[model samples]
Target chain A: MSNIQAYLRPDSLEGALALLAEHQERARPLAGGTSLIFSHPPRVEVLVDLAGAGLDHVEHAETGGVDIGSMTSCSHLATALRGRQLDKSALTDALATLYTPVLRNHITVGGNCVMVYGWSHLPVTMWALDARFMVVSHKAKPRDVDADTFFERHPLRWLGAGELLTQITVKSPAEGSGSAFLKFGRDKSDEGIASVAVSLRLQDEKVASARLVVGSTRPMPQKLDDVAALVVGKRPSKEVFAEAGEAAAKAVVASDNYLGSADYRRHIVASLVRDALAKATQRAGGAA
Target chain B: MKIRLQINGNTRELETTPTRTLLDVLRDAGYYGVKRGCEEGTCGSCVVLMDGEPHMACLIFAPAAVGKAITTIEDPDGDRPHAILRALADAGAVQCGYCIPGMALSAKALLDATPDPNEEEIRGAMEGHLCRCTGYVKQVEAIKRAAELMREEASHE
Candidate 1:
């Protein structure tokens, strides 16, 4: 018999959380089920469907940020973001590159964040934006976890027993900020082999603060602090961008896999980072 | 668990295990058009219109599809072929015919959402399906032809 023994579609969040609390590790929340249905763990006996939990939404905060509900489909988010006249296209562009259109119709934003697959691009972009994750569970008050810290370990193993990610809150970038996302894959339709996202906030035409994230080159998306250190306080120029990319290339310990060799990934990462930085710098100047 | 679904405009009740995928349920229900290629979501052979949107049936748990409208390629116009199917037939887009249903449904969903899609939009909508024979050139032309047919139908209404 299949290990998936029971499916629970709770009409209310409380009902779902209580069920999750009761079942604990035996229960797994079914978000798009793109990842879960493929690899049903032996221990997962109850699949909690959150479709009716009403977690799907994307609301622009009065404070000028966006709150993305966990169940919001990736396609919907991409359409919403594409319609917005944002100063940066990093998040929207990154989303457009994820999976095929049919898959996007099913993959949820929260599922992507929680699953944290190696080729997942949204989390890397979220990390670059310093997005905060809202998680809920029994016996714990809903709390916001920093996106940076949320993936310290593999996210699938990082969630507390029975806990579910509810929403992701991304603060609005400061004025004159620009972000860029770039992914390198075998083909335009293929998953990312290496991806880089860069966000830069410029003040007085100098990079005041910068966030750089590289994905697919490592086990998890990582922040390029060394690259940031090189770019900060420096004027936005091709020279500085290339220097930062070179530094990132040297710093990232890329893996050798079927998609690419470690050496090839390192080289691609440098060029992608350079291109992303250059595009971000140009956008920053325009925004400024 | 037993779940009720509106499949291809008919309300059907299915008794299936919670682990059963919608793909398996639909195929077992005799919707052979819902092909079972790549149990993974990568290939679009199992693509279906769930609540007016294209989704991979292979990835969707059967129970999760309850209370939603599921439209398969077989019943797009309730026995009458959809304009997308007609367009494919006219354009000679089907080769081997395995990927046609998915490609047609994707085009139908795109046209339903955006009636006037450009070449880029057609390619984007059809990006998920893998057709080994056509090189996608004829598929793109078929989608464009489908959109024109749809527009003509709407104008006459």
Candidate 2:
């Protein structure tokens, strides 16, 4: 006799979302079930199946960006993102470097976003692109929220109780914009000790816009606005790159096992920031 | 929970739990071809094709796989057959049989999707599946050869 009391395969997104709302207390939605099933929840009564809900897609929208379905697996997204979704390539390539082919095939893009504790590059890369998620609830309609605020958890707040994230949308970066993502780890499979994603919009070889995000250092991966500000309106020379790195290193904070002392993490921040900046600049056609 | 899944073209119903790893389940089925190198999902020994994608059976809960099809080395040529074994053998990539199944399956899955994988794509696809014997040189060659073989075969059609 097993305790997995029920399994429901909803045929549509709304049906699955409705089931999620109805059974939020006892049931956990399983997309690929790569992470949820591992929790060994105190109560294992139900597995709400989202696989059949027609959400596993990566479609090009008419407006030029991509509409990524919630059920899209990391490996699948990585493949689709290769030459087509270059703006989000940092996230996709990072996904390619995850543990092994096995886990990537099973891990859902939505589940990866929900597991955005810092070891992941998906959330940070998406955040750098200003991507937004469409979350639905027991309420009337689906709503959109920015990546930064969607995952921020307060001290005692258990948020997202009734919401189910549906789709992720990322607009295409301008032709002059470029991005790069890098992750450092103690071992190949060890969760990233430090990760950064840099997005830059260049104007005549000068950084008209820039965003630098760091993960695996704090409770959440966030943009170091100061670092971006340091590079904005400046040509991406070695000096500018070094300054951006230093500014990013200064922003490293303490949280969740970042593999070393705050000072060491800062050093990594500086090094990877420089590396990411140089690469992104080159991707934007700036001379390295 | 007793569920039926097609393991390498063979169907059987087995009692399992969400905590029961695919490695443990496959071991019971006598498919020793699927290695159990790392239980933490780092090693590719526990790799298997679940509905056309290579996956770590260790990370997947068994009951959640109600009607899915699983393919081990036993199902060679079932999903992306010739990409790894044939092309890799043509390229002399088999150093130790230990990592071959996982490597082969990984290569098979990648070449199935993109038959023209470059060096970086090959490295990205085979990131954590370690082959201590060949130093990855031969494995890279094997993937390339496998892609060529796949394309050659596809062109025949």
Candidate 3:
């Protein structure tokens, strides 16, 4: 039996935030708790649950973006997004393909970003979309932190305190921008050996820019800025797109090499990057 | 870890560890319909509806689910009455009968949400629940028949 003495379920954000502000050292907001409860340090005294707080909706903002509440479940995303005007269906598909129906229902979007599991698909997918999260703590008000920059800065680590991740906002894709996510796993439907998330925008069918993020390949998903610049303003035919995929694989190889041989990761990267780019291009094309 | 929870429409308080799973709680409370075939989440024999959504009971922490509503196969009414119990018997989907309860309940979750679920929806909802005896072909057929029957009932209403 856990020695935990008191468990509090707070209903209002202000009340929860006030409690967190007072007990910043010992307080941690619990969502889904798929990983937090099982893999936490032994010093936890108070478990503040956010399940009853009613922060669980996917609201399309009036300003051309979406503010997905931190507690949104992956299974709900899979079921509701079947015919929605989501800019990234491959990312949606990758989420739907998570392990099994049961786990997907329990995992929350906010926890996916905070824990940032190596096996998680959302981090890889959102990385390419230039997603940002709303980080809120009682000590400080709320602030919007860019997803990539926040990881690099390690703001959460610097503070040495738990910050509640309140929301994730992804801007509506531009006219030419298209995004896709893919993973090639050893098990037929299990976690991936390696995965890639790609986003592209073109001007006159010539690649204007691309954002490529590869997953389970390093400490975290690697951003392929150099590889993306290589194909900008170039017409991406089947051959050209294959070259771009090879460039992405090569760039990943140059960065932190995977546990697998450099050649094996490159081979898998080559295929996934190619498929993701092709799918994104088709999505961007839009039969116009 | 003495935890109080509402299980199967009744409040039963039990002592368990933070690590002790909801599967342990239900079984100790005599709700053995929540089978423990595979302690790991891979086997869906422990599938139950937490707050009306089908979830794997083995993976849930007893403390985490303290206040949430949990429904086992014993939760009465709906298609579980006519569709699952009736269809499983008619189509021979209950071989050893170990997997029938979960398969039936998971189908109840699906068919209740969608009165006329297609083959793909039923198959997707039944991903980890396995029946080594039925070969699953007849089980899928049975679930499809259940959906059709539910649809007919919906249409008549």
Please give the RMSD to the true structure for each candidate, in Å.
Answer: 1.5, 3.7, 3.2
DockQ of candidate model 2: 0.45
- Model 2 Cα lDDT, one tens digit per residue, B7-68: 87788888766456677878787888889897767778778888777888777767656678
Each model's TM-score?
A: 0.97, 0.85, 0.89
DockQ of each: 0.81, 0.45, 0.46
RMSD of 1: 1.5
Worst 10 residues of 2 chain A by lDDT: A153-162
lDDT tens digits, residue span B53-88, model 3:
888888777777877788888764634476667777
Q: Ranking under TM-score, best-scoring first?
A: 1, 3, 2
lDDT tens string, model 2, A1-288? Answer: 145677777777778778877877666777877666456666656777888778789987655578889899887887677667464456654675565556777878777777665566678787777788887777667788786676554211433555667788877767788888887778655677788888888997789998888887875787788879998998888888998888787776745453777677778888888988888888877866
Order the numbered candidates by DockQ, best leading: 1, 3, 2
Which residue pairs in candidate 2 collide?
A: B77-B81
Per-residue lDDT for A75 in model 3? Answer: 79
Model 1 spans with C-alpha error above 4 angstroms: A85-88, A286-288
Top model number, DockQ: 1
Query: Distance (Å) between predicted and true CA of B112, model 3?
Result: 1.1
Scanning candidate 1 chain A in windows of ten residues, the lowest lDDT window is: A80-89
lDDT of 3 by residue, A134-190 (tens): 877776768888868755533346433556788888777777777888887765346
